[model samples]
Target: MIKNFHQYYVYILSNKPNGTLYIGITNDIQRRILEHKQGLIDGFTKKYGLDVLVYLEMYHNVNDAISREKQLKKWKRLWKIELIEKENPKWSDLSIEWND
Candidate 1:
């Protein structure tokens, strides 16, 4: 027997350190981030220029990813900043190398 696995991502995008933030969930982080960077998706992210991939969490279950995304979205700005800084001290774009 064979089993297949699916990946989901709970990601955070920001314009700069302590700047506007966006929380989202997607199965393809690369493609999703690319779309945001290209302004292909309209709304909050595009309006605020939150294209930098500042933080991310991956899971095999979509529900888990969605739950995490929603939870993060409800978090206070300072808490979110600390979460990002814990993993990304300088708030550098984690997807900077994916320039396309």
Candidate 2:
């Protein structure tokens, strides 16, 4: 049986490829990304215009997602770039197709 199957997301936003990155964890990735795009959310993302969803990962637990978010936050820029490219080579805005 799948116990505590709640899912969470750890996502990365960027201004552009190889640009400023923001790592965050959210239970609703699509909504959160939309908020970032509309500048509804304050702080680093809004201030830096980090609206592009370049990378994302899902976890079964909030703690796992939060842990990954914190780990990615401390990663060197190059490492983060590599990680993003691994999934999104073009660094495309994954949220674009979300219709927000």
Candidate 3:
């Protein structure tokens, strides 16, 4: 028998351009982003308002996503910023239209 699994994502959120950045991995990217946007989950995201989904990289395996997130977390701030700019030069909230 075979089972289907949803893709995982390493996502980055920010308060503003050149502002605070938060990196995380999730299986349900949209739901996680919504939670961050609504301040549903407490801690860094809520306190810093790091609610703008600036970047995302999808992975077929959760292990890959977890590994990427960990690597991003250890990167120098400038490198992470560069990664975000590569796809999202404007640092737009990529999750704002998840419902659409």
lDDT of each: 0.92, 0.91, 0.91
TM-score versus the correct structure, for each prediction: 0.94, 0.91, 0.93
Model 1 alpha-carbon drift over 4 Å, by segment? none
lDDT of 3 by residue, 1-100 (tens): 8989679999999999999999989888988988888899999999999999999999998888888999999999999999999999998888866674
Number of clashing pairs, model 2? 0
- After superposition, candidate 3 runs with Cα above 4 Å error: none
lDDT string for model 2 (53-96, tens) is 99989998788888888888898989999999999999999988
Pairs of residues clashing in candidate 1: none
Question: CA lDDT of 10 in candidate 1?
Answer: 94
**TM-score of predicted structure 2:** 0.91
Candidate 3 Cα lDDT to native: 0.91
lDDT of 1: 0.92
At residue 64, candidate 2 shows an lDDT of 81
